[model samples]
Target: MYIITVEYVIDPGHMLTFMDAVLENAETSLHKEQGCVQFDVSQSHDNPTQFFLYEQFVDEVAFQQHVESEHYLTFSQKVQPAVVSKSVRHWYSC
Candidate 1:
């Protein structure tokens, strides 16, 4: 599996909006993409503005498809302005 993990720090004022957009994106990706294996969203216990995403795909091509997906593009545009900081990492199953 090709795995992707993301950590995000969002503006406090935009927390609710960001959550809604992200959740929708997750749901849409899982339902619409054949290569999308798993999508998980997490919030930090200590910080309400902190969020994380765990995504698994069949391969690198699958991951690429996801980034180009309409839902992802919409989600990116919706949340970009609200993001304070972001980090992403990729991995493969052993």
Candidate 2:
């Protein structure tokens, strides 16, 4: 399985708008993509500007395809101005 956690440091003022875009992307990925197993978004309890995304895919190829998808591209473009910084970590299950 391929799992990843993406962290987004967002500008506090744009939280709502950013969430809207990310949520749409998450829902679309989960419902429309056969390789997408899980796509979840969460806000930090202490810091509302920090967002976390937990995503699971069938494989690296599936993930690459997700990155190339139209919805994902739209989300990325829409949220760019709201984002302060972003980071991603890949996971391996034994």
Candidate 3:
């Protein structure tokens, strides 16, 4: 199994807009992607401008396909201006 976590730091003023975009992306993945086992988004209480996303895919290939998907590209383009910083971590089960 594979797991990934992505965090984004956005300008405080754009938090709401970014969250909306994230919600749209999450909905699309949940309904449309077969390999997407889990897709979740969370907000940091300590830092309102920060957001966390957790994703689980059947394997690396599945995750790669997700990255190349039209929905992902659209989300990335839509949120680029609002995002100030981002980080992604990948992990695998033993």
Candidate 4:
């Protein structure tokens, strides 16, 4: 599987809005994309403004499709302003 991990530090003022948009994006991706295998969202225990996403796709093409998806685009645009800092990493199953 192609794996993607994303970490975000969100602006505190936009936490609730960011949460809603992210959850909706996750749900939509899982339901709409055949290549999306897993999509997990996590929040830091110590810092409510920090969030993480763990995503798995069938292959690199699948992961590409995910980034091009409408839901993802919407999520990205919607949350861009609310993000303080972000990091993304990619991997593949052995």
Candidate 5:
């Protein structure tokens, strides 16, 4: 499996809207995408503006397909203005 971890620093005032968009993205991935193994969204206890997304796919191609999906594109557009910073990491299961 291939895993992607994304850290997002959202604008404090836009937290609710950002959460909505990201939640939709996660839901769509898990429910609609055949290649998606798992999708998890988490909020930092110490930082209200911080969010983490853990996504697991069958392989790298699955991840690429996810990026090309319409739901993800919409989510990206919706949350772009609300994000202050973002970081991503990739890993392969042993």
Candidate 6:
């Protein structure tokens, strides 16, 4: 399995609104993408403006496909302006 984690630091004033958008995006991604095995989002308790997204795919190909998907593109475009900073990491399950 391919596991991906994304961390985001959002603008403080827009945190709640950004999370709402992310939640909707995650729902759409999990429902529309067959390659998506899991898609979860979490907020930091210590820093509410920080968010983490965990996603799992069947394999590299599945993940590549997801990156090329419309839903992913849409989500990116929608959240781009709201994000202050973001990082992504990829891992293969042992």
Best by lDDT: 1
Across 1-94, the per-residue lDDT of candidate 3 in tens digits comes to 7889999999887878899999999889878888889999998999888899999988999899889999999999989999999999999978
Superposed on all Cα atoms, model 5 deviates from the true structure by an RMSD in Å of: 0.5
Per-residue C-alpha lDDT of model 6 across residues 31-67, encoded as one tens digit per residue:
8888888999999999988899999999999899888
Candidate 2, which segments miss by more than 4 Å at Cα?
none
For residue 84, what is the lDDT in candidate 4?
100
Error of 5 at 81 (Å): 0.5
Q: Between the candidate structures 1 and 4, which one is better when assessed by lDDT?
A: 1
For all the candidates, what are their Cα RMSDs to the real structure? 0.5, 0.7, 0.9, 0.5, 0.5, 1.1
- Model 5 TM-score, 2 decimals: 0.98
Off by over 4 Å in 1: none
Per-model TM-score versus the true fold: 0.98, 0.96, 0.94, 0.98, 0.98, 0.92
Off by over 4 Å in 6: none
Worst 10 residues of 3 by lDDT: 11-20
lDDT of 2 at 75: 92
Residue 27 alpha-carbon offset, candidate 1, angstroms: 0.3
Name the better of 1 and 6 by lDDT: 1
Best-to-worst ranking by lDDT: 1, 5, 4, 2, 3, 6
Q: Residue 63: error of model 4 in Å?
A: 0.7
Question: Candidate 2, overall lDDT?
Answer: 0.93
State the TM-score for model 3: 0.94
lDDT of 6 at 68: 85
lDDT of 2 by residue, 12-83 (tens): 889889989999999999998999999999999999899999999999889999999999999999999999
lDDT measured at residue 5 in model 5 versus the true structure, 0 to 100: 98
- Model 6: which ten-residue window has the lowest total lDDT? 12-21
